[model samples]
Target: MQEAVIGLSHLFMTVFLCCFANFMVIPAITDVTMAALCPGKDKCSLAIYITGVQQAIIGLGSLVMPLVGKLSDTYGRKFMLTLPITFSIFPLVILAYSRTKWYFYAYYVLKTLIAMVTEGSVQFLALAYVADNVEESRRGSVFGIMSGFASSSFVFGNVSTRFLSTSATFQVAAAKSVIALLYMMVFLPESVVKYRTESTETDCLLEKPPTKTWKLFKTLPSVNDIICLLRTSPTFSKAAVVAFFSNMADVGLHASLMYYLKAQFHFNKDQFADLMIIVGIAGSISQITLTPILTPLIGDEKMLSTGLFFSCAHMIILSVAWAPWVPYAAAMISIVATFAQPCLRSIASKQTGPSEQGKAQGCITGICSFANIVSHLAFSPLTALFLSDNAPFRI
Candidate 1:
């Protein structure tokens, strides 16, 4: 256990710092986007529209993740772990330096292309890491504990952004990514022992290794494997669909959240940070405690469904929130809803054999990617349209 924790320390620490950087980006991007796109307008709905475009790229970027995950299974987790963080530095630096819409557009396009290899995939990687290292019997509890630490990074990250300039924050994030890479290079060992052994066993069975690159390419999962992974397992498929809807709801909220609060309540960066801090604290606590306690009593499926119902409640409450504090109330009420992702991961990871954990997570990430495309196209524009003069939900 101690050795496993030591090996996973690098992975967990990197995830925390990356999440910190991500939370920092949330508040700054809205203002940067507004300044870049439409400086004169007080309520710049166009910023939301551009966010939609960026999310579309992120969604499309998810296509490569399954392949990356497969590559991790074949090669080792270190490369998949390192590559995304390495490539993401360019996009962060570009955002910090550039102000023009054209530059922003370039960043988004490049961000999409390199999405599989960045800090955004940290949670996905962490999930796989836990699946890889932990005993199957103890995975659920360990996953929750790990997720709690990861979620808590948002609190500190949000607070940090309140004091720093936007450029400084971005630079800090970029620097953190660099540090994460160094830590991984120096300390993180491979978490693919089972995958390596299983592959070796299979290779030993083969009389001779094939020469063609086309045949070599056959080592990774195909389109059929991606689809079949989702379709074949009832629990995994349900979790996938739930994750899809969960992300759809989440992206829709996120697409409009900052804008809505800023437009209605006149929330500045500090206020936005406060909201994130509240949610982050509540979520981190709940993430650590709730799933382990409930899973034994209700099992994974019941726990999942319960979390979804609470999540749906969260969305509905946020949609009709009449005052600024209402979002905070909704946050508190939905602490248990944070259980959804960990439970979903726990269930799916349990169903999958050890050797295929990467494929399972890749499939899950693929479903979320498709949802991002749909949510980006749907939610951001809808928020813009609603915030306009001729809409039904005028406040």
Candidate 2:
């Protein structure tokens, strides 16, 4: 137990550094995109459309995330985690070096390509790692703690962004990304040994031949594999439904919200960072303090429902936001809404065995990726249209 706690502490630090690297650049990226594409204008159809395209392609590529997860089940989680974290650094390095128009375009293309693998894989693998180390009874609370760490990173990153200039933001982000990768490699221990022991015992009992290294790719989970896993329990199927729609809402909000604020309220990088800090602080406190207490008492299912309810309320509030302050008020609802993810993840993790953690988490993440594709397709054009000067009908 002591060793497991120590390992989990390392995992948390790795996740914090990686998330900090990613989150710190969000406000800067918006300004950079607008500056490169539209010069001085806040409402840029070109920027919106380009962002939508990047998101769509990333979603298409992320359909392979389940395969990555399955591979982690075979290879070590540390090895698989290393790949995305390493790739993530390159995109940041491009922007850090220069934010010129052509350089921005170069960064855009590379970022889209790399995000396909790194987007959701890190969180999924981290959850799988936690599952491997922690038992089922305490899993929900532990998941909340993990998310708390991530939310804390989000707050710190945004705070950094609020103070730093755009160039410094990306440079610091790139440096942090490198540090995250190195930390994981050096400090985070592999959890795959537990799964390997289980596999070896089953193989010995059945007299199974060792799998060849060349055939590893052939063993990737198929459509049927996903279908069968979903059918494993009714609870899992319902959780998948929740994951899809919840993620869809999230992606749609992410796709439109910043642009909407920029267009509607003339919010710049500082304001964007402020809004994110509000949400992040709320999320961090709720996940760290509230979730651990409430999850055991009310259970993950009830907690999930409650979280989703608040999530919807926040979105509705944002949709009708009249004043700039309204958005900040809406952001505070994340205190409860943030409960959705860790609770949902805990529920899903309970439905699978020890060996299948990666596959199960990966499958759910793939569903969320599909949601990302759908959200971009459905919301991106509408966002561009409504925010553009060429809007058919203005509110």
RMSD of each: 3.9, 3.0
Candidate 2 lDDT by residue in tens digits, 77-173: 8888999999999999999999989999999999998888778899999999999889888888889989999999999999999999999999999
**lDDT for residue 115 in candidate 1, whole number 0-100:** 68
> What TM-scores do the predictions have?
0.89, 0.94
Q: Pick the candidate with the highest lDDT.
A: 2
Candidate 1 off by > 4 Å: 1-7, 98-106, 116-120, 195-216, 393-395
lDDT of 1 by residue, 300-347 (tens): 677777778888898889888899899888887557887777778888
What's the distance in Å from true for residue 346, model 2?
0.9
